[model samples]
Target: MSKLEDLKTAVINGKRKDVKTIVPELLESGADPVEMLEQALIPAMSVVGERFKKNEIFVPEMLVSARAMKEAMKIIEPILIEAGVKPEFKALIGTVEGDLHDIGKNLVATMWKGAGFDVVDLGVNVSPAAFVQAIEEHSPHLVGLSALLTTTMPAMRDTVEKIRGAGHDKVKVLIGGAPVTLEFAREIGADGYASDAASAVDAAREILAS
Candidate 1:
């Protein structure tokens, strides 16, 4: 098989060691870093996302695959930046305050990266103030809030309210996690909701299109 296909298989198989080795070889062999990102790494993650959405793969497997792609990204990102290749869109993602869960948030972040959005991950237990500050600083087209516990739903609501009230009207809020639903998202004034990472990509794209 071709080297690009090998790279894709390495990511799909979660072969981080192979990815680390292959990425440098590809770099030395005149491979375009952006093409490597767009053609191989992202597609592998996109397949992983789809499998996760379909329940064919679970969080553990998804994490493994994402880590492999992340290794490749670590090598490719600097080259892309140095070459003046920037992603066309931006997103800010985080888990709301009082909720320490991050699996869902991390998955969505990976999917966003796969979909070519430059994602800023704010990590777990993000406060409303922090969200507002990030909005002002990043001015991202999309924001994602994750909460694994029902108790943290209120925090998600408060966060969305704070961002909206802060007059960041152009920023679209997206809500997700085990506890967040369409009704809850609507009540909290979120612009979108996705049950899994693959759909999160679709939701973000739709928000961007609108």
Candidate 2:
């Protein structure tokens, strides 16, 4: 495989050191940052996500791979910005109120960023009112909620309801986490749900297109 392809595969395998080393090599070898991002980094994360869903990989692997990808991103993001390659969509992401967990949320956010969406991470313990305020301010194409605990699931539902109540139904809502199931997502009035980071990108793309 070419250097870019090698870089991508390394990222998919969660080789943080390789990503850190190879990204700059690719740049020095005259690879376009945009091409590297689209052809390599994005697809690498997509594969990681797929593996996660298929049980070929777990959260620890996914997080490490995402961290590697972010390391590469540190080099390429500025070039993409300079080249005027803005993200195709904006996303607001957060863990719901009463939930302090963030690893899952951060993984999804990184994947979204890799997918070329401008992600506005609301951080952990975000309330319904905060979600509304973010929607009003960012006008994101998608609003993502993550809850790791069964106890915090209600906060996801309440946040969704509050968004609807605030008259921003046009903005799509997405939910995910260890305890969150597709049935629960539907029940909470979410537009979509993904069990892992890769599917989350696909779902976000579809929601934005609709």
Q: Best candidate per TM-score, number?
A: 1
lDDT score of model 2?
0.88
Candidate 2 has a TM-score of 0.82
True-structure RMSD, every candidate = 1.9, 2.7
Q: Candidate 1 — which pairs collide?
A: none
Collision count of model 1: 0
Model 1 scores a TM of 0.89
- Evaluate all candidate structures by whole-model CA lDDT and list the values in order: 0.89, 0.88
Candidate 2 differs from the real structure by a C-alpha RMSD in angstroms, to one decimal, of 2.7
Model 2 regions more than 4 Å off: 148-152, 178-184, 196-198
Candidate 1, superposed: residue stretches over 4 Å from native:
none
Among these predictions, the greatest lDDT belongs to 1
lDDT of 2 at 176: 93
lDDT of 2 by residue, 1-210 (tens): 899889989988888898888998989989999888889988888888778778988788887887888889888889888988877788999999999999878888977876767899999999999999999999888999999999999999999999999999899998999999989988989998888765788888777777
- lDDT for model 1, on a 0 to 1 scale? 0.89
